[model samples]
Structure formats: structure tokens, C-alpha cells
Target chain A: MKLWLTCLLFACMPAWADAPTTPTDAATWLNRVAQATHQLTYQGVFVYQSQNIMAISHISHLIDNNGEISRLDALSGPPHAFLRIDGSVYCSFQNKPSGDIEHRPHHSFFPEVLPYPNTHLNNFYQVRSLGHAKIADHDCEGVLLIPRDAYRYGYALWADSTSHVLLRLIKLDAHGQTASQLTFTQIDIGHAPTRAQLSIDFNDKLPIKQSGNETEPKAVWQITNPPSGFHRVTETVMTLPDHAQPITHLVYSDGLATVSLFIERQTQPNTFHQQGLVQQGQMLLYTRPMGQYQVTAVGAVPLATLVLMADNLAPIERK
Target chain B: MSHLAYANKPHQTDGGHDYIALISAGFDGELDDQELLTMLDRHQSDINASCWQTWQLIGDTLRQSPSTHPSQLAQRVAEQLKHEPTVLAPKPLRAMHTRHMMSLAASVSVVALVSWSALHLALISPHTTQLASSAPASSHAIQIAQIDPARLASFVAAHRDFALSADSPDTDTSTQNTAEPTQ
Candidate 1:
């Protein structure tokens, strides 16, 4: 009888483990989706849509002993391609090589659309299982992340049932409208992509924009009233092209959504400044002119959230 | 010249308020010879020059003309003021018009392509299989306000770096070879 029970338990374990019966189980499934995205080698075409704008891109991701390498080519709109080897990114626009490759601290794209596990999104987002469905003829389990407050947007994620790879993601606005979406039409998981498929010639005298050598400057500005659950992540001072003065950049995140505040001294007296709010797809930018300084806050959050943070930003008075 | 005569007009007020009215009328082509000459003379003043440029930009925007950067407009206006005898003449202004029309044209084409693909995908793509419960369509329309597109694009690019931090420190760097492609 014991031998018979052992066989039955082993046979049913796969199905039992995949199904989420509680909220905690749903969170676990999300964790699995995050893990599969980075650990497995995948190549696919995904469609990104936001409001009236739509773009299709082909992405090839490879994970080997040398770390992760991904090449993304835009199949629609303007001709452009992005090659990411770990944290560094290279770009080619209109078949012309980019002059500099930017080294970012963290970067994410379509399939790799999840926050770090340590972010503990469950604190701000209520994870729930939306059951199962088929996407691109592959069975997928759906998970919904509903925001606990109005400060942040929500997300609906659908992961492959067999591999737990995220196949689709829909970002929802505060009113539950689809703010933006990314869905894979076809995917090849676990197949190693050739080196040539993930390679981009940086040997053409293209300078690498190094971020590791950048030193963190003293924090001279502070956001007095950030929205709920949002906290400062990183701050740095860097010289942007065309600007004579260095810009102070601060990054804030609520795990999923991030907001960047840029402050620069106004050197030219006649420089025309752009003020007020601007919307680009799911993102919002708010610019406010402080005394002798230009302050701008850019993020995927709502206009009110940005306004609240931008209005309350104050410079630290040094003795 | 006519400007010197208009600058000495008895009825002209010393305050910038009178020039402001003339500037507004100049945009509508309602200024008479005397008023037009007076407006041109006042255009040299720092306050009046700024006022004139703002009114011109507003008129161009209302007429659905190609959008130009405010700084660019200021530079062109300053250049015309330096070389051209008549700063407010329509011929000089029209010569420098629509410097950034190509970007606007590109934006229109991109929108058209996106609309076409969205319809095509919905009709034929197998990935349209909806999984989540359908919510009521939002009635809200996004309003594109007056802001510098180039400056906004830079901010958006910077924000993207932090927005998508997918790789976690806890993420296992070791590759998983057991999974197979679902062909």
C-alpha cells in the first residue's frame, strides 16, 4: 500500500506544484517567472503596444559562462538595434554605429520585465492568480499584480505553464485600463543562441561609456514628499552631451516603477526652458524651474505623483 | 526712417503695455503703417522683443505650422534683427520657417504604421488570445502639451535605465539546461 501511494504522489506532483491555491503560491509563481527569464536561453518576437503606438521587436537572449548577452532588433518603425551584454548597451540607428555604448547599472526589456526578487513587490502589490489560458498556442498561467495604492500602476503577467517563462505582460493604469502591453508571438526557449547572433562589433573605435568609474557625489538635493512606498535608489552626477554643466541625477523606485529627477544649473541667461507636464505613452514628465536651477521628474507614474515629488524637492543647504 | 518717425509719435505710451497691444495686432496683420513702424521700433527693447517672439510662436502653433524649438526661434529672430533692415517683415520670417518639419512628418508616418499594425495583429495574430478578465475601456484621451521633444526624450532615456532592473543580485547566474523548447 505504501509503495502504491508513493507512485501516485510522484505522478501528481507536477500538476500539484504548478497550480497556485493561495496568494503566497501566486507570489511563488511570479518568482519562478523571474528566475526563468534570466536562467534560460530564449529567442522570440514580441509586440509592444502603448495607446496608439505599436512596435514589434525580435530579441535573442543567451546565458553562458561569460554571463548574459542579448540582441534586440526593431522590426517596426525606425530602423534601430540594441545589443546588451550584461549591464552595458550598444545601439545602432539607421545602420550607423552609435558613438558610445552606455553602461547602465540595471536595465530591463520585454521578456525580462520583473523587479528584483529582493524588492518584495508583495508589500506594495497584491498578487493574485488569474487562472490559465493559451498564448501563441502554448498553455500559460496568468498572475495579476494589483497596486495597494494609487501611486503605482499594476501589472498582469502570463507565464508559460511548462517552463514558467513570462510570455505576456500588460501594464494597467490606475483605472484598470491597459496602459501598455508586451506579448510574445513565438518563442524558442532553452536553445543556445550562436555567438554571432548575440554579437555586435564594438571594435569600430566605439568608446564604451563606463559607469563603474563614476564616483557618487555628495547628495545636495532631497525629495521632501515622495509618494507612498517609493524610496531613493541611486544618485550620481554626470555630464550629458551638449550641456556645459554636469547634471545631478537621482533615481527613485517603488520596486516596479522608477522615477528619475534631473537637476542642472542654468548657466545661460537666455536659455529657453520647457515647463509643465508632458506625456509619452505610459510615462509622464514634469518640469519645474527652481531658482537658477531646472528640475525635471520623469517616470511611468501618474502626473500627480510626479508633481508631488517635483514640487517638494529642496536643495540641502551646506554650512 | 519710418521707425524713427513712429518712435517719436505723441500718442505712444512709455510703458510696454502699448507695445504689447501693437505686437498682438501685428500678428493678425491689423497694424496700420504707423502702428507697424512703432511695433518694429519697440521690438528692439528686451521686454518687447521677448513679447514679439512669444506672440509669433503662438500664432504659428495656432495655424498648425511645423513646430520649432523656442530657443531656435529666438536665435533666428535675433539673427534677422541683426541683418535684415525690417525685423518684422513677413518675407524674412517666412524664409526661416519650418526648420524642424521633418521630425513632425516622421512622427505622423510612425503613427500611421502603428495603427495599421495594431489592426493587422488583432485580426490575424494567434497571440490575441485574451487571458485576463476584460476591463471597461478607458474614455480618457492623452493630451500632448507644448514641451520640447528633444529634452523630453533625453529624460525618458535616462529614466529607462532605472525602470527596468530585471536582473537581481539573488538571481542565480548558473544556467539551467534541463528545460526544453516547446516546439
Candidate 2:
């Protein structure tokens, strides 16, 4: 009688055995991250490391109730820095203006992956709270962004305890190995980020105009043909400094992904069959051919997603 | 443009590092400067030299043809042959655009490819079987030869690009067909 009672007692409390220490409340944590990035004013230095690339970016973001934002990233590689005052993006390279990049607003959900319907994410990734840890000397709550489908990589996020901002993120491949990591080394959250810090120190000096706007007339190319859910936002004609001719630039974005199309003079024959997947740190790129143009589409997305985006680039008409 | 990467670090894997893959990106104007730097960094020797040569070759080909995709070669000439507009004399000729193709794919994805391939050894398309059916390997019992789809799904999932074409006498189609028989 005693033995049977003991066995029954253990069986009745089985739920206790599988429980994790300080389980993360997934929904609450997600809401917290969304709110913090959108509502908070922050300044920090973070490193983005991927398959074969390592870049350090210093960002200062200021957000007010208006939803209008201002930011700057002192990029340590590629020898350029980016500054944004409101909607305009200023690049120190290409000697371009401190204005908008004639580039289209294709599928860029940076700072925050906006317009993202959380419903879709749930289908692809199993959100899990993986206890607590410390990142950059700050206490954090850990959550695993496990892939429910093999179409994309998974991510692990460690969000700050007090503010709930993501302090670190690890992107993993199919074998659950680290493919890339973005982690904050120093951070400060508050109402004001100094204007001095927001200003980009260009060329170790101020930016000098490269020249008069050599920007040719914007191309009227509209991709009357596009993959599903994608739309052409901008089409422009750009002059290459190294190459002698101006090229057509067409950009398209589905609410969450972007594809860049360049139509230049074809300089080679299609003798080589180069297809499949390629990687540069955390970014996966897919190369394919589209009419007359060399379509090379790269994004920090799943290889399948990039491949689909590249394959469906159709010609635009004057509609 | 720095040789420091080659100088400082050891080669991670010899045969697998794909420099041309990234440089191919440069040819299209997609790679940002940092990405270009990283590629140059990892491949400072013969690999880098070969990648530049490949770019030159591609550029020559494109300049020569300036009218089409650099990767769609003489092989797909057959597909282009089908592209020739046929006249249903006096009737309005409609262009079967890419949208139509994708719509067809989305609709059929449910009926033919993904679902039933779960069990059957071979699934062939009702309308088209463009696979050459000659990929060597599977020569065991119950040869499930998929013509286009039930075959196409696995092909799409694995390669992202595929077409179906088959000829008789070559069980190559049988062995290569990606289709699984109806469950």
C-alpha cells in the first residue's frame, strides 16, 4: 500500500519535472521589446558579426511621441557612416547629398520590424522563454526564436531586464550553430541623446560636396511584373563613377523583404551556370538571371526567401 | 582592399569558400563596399584573381548579348523556342506573363506537388514534364520516376529553379523525376 501511494504521488506532480528555471513569459516579453524600441530614446555601440563579416555600429536614436525619429550609425567598415535626421538618409560615401537615398523603401524594417503581423511569425518560429542571463553587464531575459520551418534561420534574443530592449541576438543555422551575432557592448536609455553625438564626423572632417548632382533623370522603369505581395517603390538612373555608363536601378519590397535590380550593359555571355546559395556573414544571397539584367538579390533573410525574390523579378512597363 | 585578412587568419575551409559567389554579387551592383572588402579579405590570392577573371568573362558575355540574362544559356534555347508567339490567325493573341505562371504554380501547389509527394514514389504533371529524366543515381526496386511535379516540389524546395523535359529509352527521367506516387 505504501509503495503504490508513493508512485501515485510522484505521477500526480509530473508537471514539476519538466519546468525550467524562471521561465520567460513570451508574450509579455515580446510586447515589452516592441514597446521599448518604439518608445525609448537610446544610444549605444553594438557589433554585428556574421559568417564572414564583422562590423561595429554606433547608433544614437531619439524618439518622441510624434513617432518621428532621428538616428546615426558610425559604421566602422566599408569606410562610411550613415546619418538620418527624420526621413532623410545621409551617406558619407559616394559623396552623395545629406538627403534621402534615391533607393526605394523596399522591405526595410529596421530599428523595428514594423508592419509585421505577429501571426505569421508564430507559424514559422516557436517562441520560447529560455530563462535569464547577463549581456553586456546588464541582466536580461532569454528567449529562443526556434524555426518551425526550415525556410529560414532561428534567432535567440536576450532582452534587458529593466527596459526590455534586446541586448543581444544570436542567429543560428539548421544545425543550431551560431551563424551571426549582434550584441550591444555599451548602452544608455533615456529621453535625450546629445546632438553632438548625432552628427557624423565625416572624413575625420566635415563632408565636402563631391560635385553637382550628377544624378541623371530617375528611370521610369516600373516592374509591371513582380512576385506576389511585392511592389516597386522607386526606379532611378544612376551614374557609376568607376564604369562609364549610367545604370537603371529598380527596387521592390514586399512589406518585409527588399530586392534591388540593376540593369547595366551586359558585359559577358551566360556561359557559367552559377546558382544556389552563398553567404556573407549573417546575410544569405541568391544569384539568378532575369531578362537583360543581372539580378543579384541579397538580404538578411532565408535563402529560399531570397531565391524566390530573385526569381520573380519581372520587367516593368510605363503604365 | 586589405590583405590583412589573409595575413592574419588561417584559411577556414579550402574547397568550400565561394569568392566568385560574392563577386558575382558585385557585378550586379548589389554588394555594398563592406561586403566587397570582406570578400577581398577572405580571398587575397589565386581565388581573388580567379574571381576577377570570372567577372571579366561574365561582363564580356553580357556586353556581347546585352539582350538577355547572362545565366540562361544555349540549353534553354529550347524554352525560348517555345516562346515564339504563334498566331491563332485573326484571334487576339494573349501573352502568358510571369504572373500567370506564378498563379498557376500557387494553385497547383495544392493539387499536384507538395501534398501527395508525401507517399507515392513518382508524381508526374498532367500538362508538362520538362525534366530531362537523366540524373544518374537511383537504380533500385520500385523506380519512381516523376516527370515534372510531384517532382517539381522537391526540386523547387531544393534548387529554387527547375523545368521539366523528358524523352523515352532513358529511365534517367524515371530515376531523376522528383515526383512521389500518390499516397
Candidate 3:
């Protein structure tokens, strides 16, 4: 009777025994990370490594009644500070006369991965939990997002078990080797940043030059063929500092990776240049000349993707 | 305390240090009469038998100085040769006056070929470095010099606001992708 009771007790144990210490559902775990980033006030230093190059930047995020204000100071590079007040960004470089301001929709820097809508993700990626790991002195749950197709890269993300804040991220190539990695070496969460830490001190003499001016020119160009799962997120006209005319810019994203297309009318005489494909680490650049206008596509995607998108650009005829 | 210190206690035959020491000695051919007898006794234990086999393989590797077998090496060589380009014999020299004309034509052809190759290399050279650097082993400097940190900072800041607003259902409808005319 005693032996039977013991066996029954063992079999009747709670289902929580099989459940992971962290959330198993990738969407919920990722959403937790995104929520923590916006709601929590924290300060930390993160290292971005791609290939042989590594850069260290200090970030301080503060939330108040007005909105969330954050500051990023580069510790490794030359004197550079980035201050973001809600959606407006103010950047100050040691060489530049004035800090440039741009208003755009963006997200977290360290844990750049968010739970993008997973409606079509299952077809392209295989998401799984890599169990648990210790990162930056905190116990974290590792999640692996493996790409099923060759069109995209894979990612290994580690989110803090307690706070749900992302601790480490690794971008993997097709062969499963790490292509780039981002990790928070040290983090102090729950501590609010001071006013001075979140503030940007701009040059008094020079006015802030807003890039991608609100004046959005009508987009006459269209991408005839975009890869499946990608959608047009935004279309706007950006008046660059060096150029006299405004360039039409179109942004596309598949909820994970983003690609920007800049269509500029080339009017400079004797400016004929060799134009095609150029790459820097993960970012690929593709340029295609169409009559007097040059179309440049930039993204942190495969070279083939950029080439395809660049080649399929068509001018829309307006009646 | 350290695990190693705890493991070295007396009355622990399961630790297998004695058997490992004997195996090392046997591998080095330094096992004397007493050590050889000790190894023979330990060989009865299943753990020591596995360790003994591993030690034999290690001894064999050390004695032979690790290398592919001759047959395997020959197979690999043959496989490589299959991919290698074959060398053709030079054409027999032509007769006197025709040979002079042929030699002049050959010189001109060689110059044209060299110039064409050089120009082709020059055109493709810059792009090759950009692509080759993508390989993990290549030591290509990050081409982020073109990325203005100031601009990126502004974009990130702008993105923060978008993320915040996008999270809320009520305020989401307010910010439409807007485009104003350039003044």
C-alpha cells in the first residue's frame, strides 16, 4: 500500500514541473522584453560586435509624465552623444557644428528584437527555447529564432528571467555561426536616470537641422516586386544637406528586418560613377540607375534581396 | 572545498587514479614488474578496461605521430586532381615566314589579353573587397564610417516615441505617416 501511494504521488505531481523557469511561448517572452524596455527606467552599457569591430555605448533610459527620454554616450568612439526625447532624436558629434534632429519611428538599441507580429513568421522561421543561461550576472532564458529560408538570418536572444529585459543577442548566419553579437556587459535596472544624464547640450550658435523634413514628396516610384511577408511601412521625402532637391524615401519591413529605398534624381554633370552593389558587414547597398534618377536601396539583409528590390523599381504614372 | 581535494581521499577505488597512472606508465612503456602486475589486477574493473583502450589509442597516436593512412592520402590526392585544370602540350612551331607573322600576331594578342584582364580586374577589384570582407575570417574594417552617428541617434530617438505610441491603442491613430511640402 505504501509503495503504491508513493508511485501515485510521483505521477500526480504538478504540470509546473515540466514548465520552463521562463515563459516558453516566444511571443509572450518577446512581448515581455518590449514592455520592460519602455516601462522600466534603467541605465547600462552595451557592446555591439560585428566581425572584428566592437563598439561600447552607455545608455540611460528615463520615463516621466511627458514621455520617455533616453541618452546614449559612446565610450569607445570619439566624443559623440545621442539624446532622444520621445520620438525626436538629437545627435551631437565633436566635429559637427550643430546637432541633427530626426523624427522617425524606432525602438530599443540593446534588445533591438521585439515580438513582431508572428502571423507569417511560422512559415519563415522556426522558434524554440534554448533553455536557460546566465548573462551579465543575471539568470536569463535563451530563445533561438532560426530562419527556415535562406532569405533571412537567424537570432539567439537571452532575456532576463526576473525582469524580462533582454541581456544578450546573437545574429547567426545560415551555417549557424555567429555573424554579429550584442550583449549588456553590466546593467543597473530599476534605477532612474537623472535629468542631466538624459539631457542633450547642443551648440548655442548653430540651429538644429531637422533631417527628412516633414515635407514628404509624393512617391512616384514603386517597387514592383518585394519579397513575400514584407510590407510598405512608410514613404516620405528627405531633403539631404548636400543635395539641392529632395529625395523620395520608402521604408519596408517584414516586422523584423527593415530596408530603406532612396530615389534621387541625378543632375550633376560629369558625376558618372560606377554603381552597383556595396556591402558593410550585415548592411548591403544596391544602386540602380534609371535614366536621370538613381535608386539606392540599403538594408541589413542578403545582397540578393537588395539587388532584386533595386532591379524591380518602376515609375508609377499619375493621370 | 575543491572537488579534486575531496576526490583524492583514501578508500576510494572508484576514483580510478591508480588505474589511470598505470595506464599512463604502460602507454609510455615504463611499466615495471610490480606496476604491470597492478594493471593486470585493475583490468578486471570495467572502468579501467575502457581507460586502458583509450590509453592504447593515445599511445598508438603518439608512437605513429598522427597522419592520414597512405591509401586515404592517395584517395584525397586523386580527388583533388579531378578538380585541377589539365595542362596541354604547346602547339608545334610553324614554318619560317609564316612563323615570323605568327610570332608578331601572338605578341599583339598577348598585349591585348593583358590589357583586357587588367581593365577587368580594375573594374571588379573595389566591389570584390566589399563582398570578400563579409566572410567571417576576413579582416575587413567596418565600413560604418559612412553612417553618421548623429543621424542614427536622432533616428533611434524618433523610434522610441513611435514604439511608445504604437504600444497604446488609443493614441495609435493620431500619428499617420505624414509628408509635408518642402518650403
Candidate 4:
């Protein structure tokens, strides 16, 4: 009887040791965040910090019968508003007329949210849960995504526990130093935004206009050898009102961060030129003469990233 | 705390270990007046003196303590003298064996004085060939030279995937392009 009792106790040991609560993994949590950011309605004031540059913006996102409508108004500095209706983006500056609307999917002004769900993000980044944190007065689960390779930087992401919306996003450099941080100071989840909050009403006296062709043309220029994982996503020819000639813009992305390359023909000899690389905030700019054209690659990626893109800039050859 | 915790069994027979522990205790200010006197007496012997130094060095290394000992300056002078040719003849001093201590002190002081003079001369005299500053002057330039604002704005405006800036509300509409289309 004593032996039988001991055997029974041993049988129940594993059950007693097992924990009842199971926290969500990083991938599932991230997927939920990507969904919540697009599907839900939220309004918040977020602060973006890049080195010494700190800008606060009030953002409101509403999903109506038509589609998603988001508005981001700069709270500090000169007043500026970036309003989006479905896929069209409109801009307004302080004391200036509203800018032309463009037909393109808007960028996530908030860092916590990414526009696309990168299914293969796990292949490049090893995601790990960093326990719990409180952000914007809400309990959040923080996750650190360390890059598997040097081609891209890492990210420290935090999602709201209840809604799974991203509450904070920190871009870490190759050396693990914080390159930039974007966090919401205050946020209201599931809040029905007023029409005024989601709308951008420009002054009647201010002139409003659109610039450039309606659609982006095929990319004439191509990166001969782009770094691993980076792919050219969008190519467009932009004709700014002030510039004499149109500039060719090519965008490359590694799932998360983006690099923008601008190519323009050197119409006249530049007497004064500041060439090489210039880093401002999280953006790194590398400009050099590419034969007859001046190529400038700008992005939040490492200097090596821009250099790689700049070295491989060439006109695409048609067979 | 465990390091400070006394050994359960004291092995007085182990001279080196006992002395090291006592020296460590003396350094930690746990030694009483009698124990401190005992430590001082042990410090006088050559073997114990060297052992005390080694133990102190180990403790300092473990604590990551910056060495501000005056002996460092003497060591530097000694090292400088190793490379330098003997200036003052030790031959005359070597004959007087009774004044050996005085002779050693005199030699050390002379080396120290010579090292001091060499340092002073290096600092006072300017070099004819000036190497460029290790840090480029432009790198440290505090004021960021402003490029053509219009040109920079145009480039930035054009390069932006989407128009993010509301600074210029003109027909600029490319800042939004920076954001990639959803998967």
C-alpha cells in the first residue's frame, strides 16, 4: 500500500509543475498587431525621437464603409497635416496652401504599425519576447527582433496587451544602440473618431493642386547588385514644380525599413557640390555623380546600405 | 557577503593562505589594533611583503580599482632609465659599499630628474613638422553648413516615398511613396 501511494504521487508530479498561463509567441503577437493596426479605429499622440530630432504628431485612424481614413497633424514646430482618404494622400502646411493629392498607399506615420505583414520576417529576424511593459498608460507585451544578418537593423516592438496594436517601436542600430524611437504618449483604442478628426479642411484662399503623372512609370534605372534581402518595390518619375527636370525615384525595402534612391540628369555643371554621405536623424544620404546623372540614396538604413545601393546604380538594359 | 564570511575551519599551518586572508582582512578594515600591528610586522619581512603586494594587486584587479599609487611614477622613471645611457658614473659610488643605499637613491633621483627634463623639453619646444590633427577639423565643425534650402527641399521632396512634410503645401506629393504597399 505504501509503494502504491508513492507511485501515485509520482504520476501527478508533472501536472502540478506545469504552468496554467501560456503567453503568446512573438510571431502570433506581431500578426495580431498587424491586423489590429489596419482593422481597428484608434487615435493617439505619438512622439518620434531620432537622435536630437523629436517631433510630436497627433494621429487618428478611422475605418468607414469606403475604406481606411487616417490623419496625422504635427503638434509641434510649424503646423502640418498629412491626411489620407483610402489610397490617396493629401498634405497641408502652416500658412501654405494644401498640396496635391497622390494616388498611393500611405506610409504608417506610427512606427509600431507596419503597412504590410512580412510573412518571412522571421527568416531575417529572430523574434524574442521581452516580458511585459506599460506604454501609453496601457499594459503592453514587448518583443525584441534581432536581425540574423548585418544587412538590416533590429527592432524593439511593444504591442498593447488588450488590443494587440503596436504601442511602441524602437529601431536599433547594428551595434544594438537605439537609432530611433517612436512611442505613443497617449492613445484611445476602439474610440469612434468624429468626422472632423478624420477630415482635412484646407483654407479656401489657399491653392490646392496635384503634381506629376497619375501612375509611376517602369524603372529605367536598376541596382545592379542590391544587398541581400533588399528588393526594389516602387519606381516613379517625380516632376517637382520647382525643379527643371523630372527625378527618377526608386524605393527598396527589406520588409520593414525602406531606402529611397533619386536619380536626376545633371543639366548643368554643379560649381559647388557637397558629395559623399550625410546622415540626418535616422536618414542616411549618399550622393555622387553617376555619369551624366546625380544619384542620391537616402534611408534610415546603415551607411553601408546606402553605399551598396549607390555603387550598383545603373540604367536597366532592355534585351 | 560569502567572501567576507569567515572560513569554517582556520588552517593556521598554511602560512601563505593565512597571511593572505589576514592581509585581505586588514585591507577591509576588519582587523583590530592587535591584528593590524601583526599585519604590519608581517609586512616588514621580504616574503610577506611581496605576498602582501600580490594579494593587494589581486584585490585591486577584482575591484577594478584605479591604481593611484606613487610607485607608478617611480616605475615609469625606472623604465625610462632602462632605455637611457648611464649619464652619472656609478663607478665612484660602487667603491663605497657602506653608502650603497645613498648611491641607489642618488641614481633613482637622477633618472627621475632626467625624465622630468625630457618631458618638459618635449612640451616646451614646438615641432617643425606639424602633422594634421588626428580628428578632421570638418568632422568636428559644430555648425552644420546649410546647403541650398530650395535644392535640398526639392531633392528631399522628390526622394520621399510619400510626402510626409506639411512644411511646403505646394504640389509636392511624393513623401507618401516611402511607405511600401501592403502585402
Interface RMSD of 4: 18.9
lDDT of 1 by residue, B1-183 (tens): 343354455554455565565555545445454556555665544433466468767755544465776667777777776676753545433222222233443454565556656544432321222312232232333344465554565555556667753221011112111111111
Off by over 4 Å in 4: A1-28, A92-107, A111-113, A200-215, A269-275, B1-149, B157-183
The residue ranges of model 2 lying beyond 4 angstroms of the native Cα positions read A1-32, A51-54, A64-81, A91-119, A200-279, A282-284, A300-303, A315-319, B1-183
Worst 10 residues of 2 chain A by lDDT: A100-109
Ranking by TM-score: 1, 4, 3, 2
Best by DockQ: 1
Q: Report the C-alpha displacement of residue B115, candidate 4, in angstroms.
A: 48
Candidate 3 lDDT score at position A290: 68
Per-candidate TM-scores read 0.58, 0.46, 0.55, 0.58
The per-residue C-alpha lDDT of model 4 at residue A91 equals 61
| I-RMSD for candidate 3 | 21.7
Model 4 Cα lDDT, one tens digit per residue, B1-183: 332233323333346566566656655545444444444443423223345455556544543465644355345444554565434344432234224434544554565556656543422321111111121123222223344545555555544435222112222343332211221
Candidate 1, residue A31: how far the Cα is off, in Å: 2.9
Candidate 1 positional error at A7, Å: 38
Model 4 residue B85 CA deviation in Å: 68
For candidate 2, the C-alpha RMSD (Å) to the true structure equals 35.5
DockQ of each: 0.06, 0.01, 0.03, 0.04
Residue-by-residue lDDT tens digits, candidate 3, B15-53:
466546644654343444344334434442333334544
Candidate 2 lDDT, tens digit per residue, A51-91? 55566666667775545444435355333345545444444
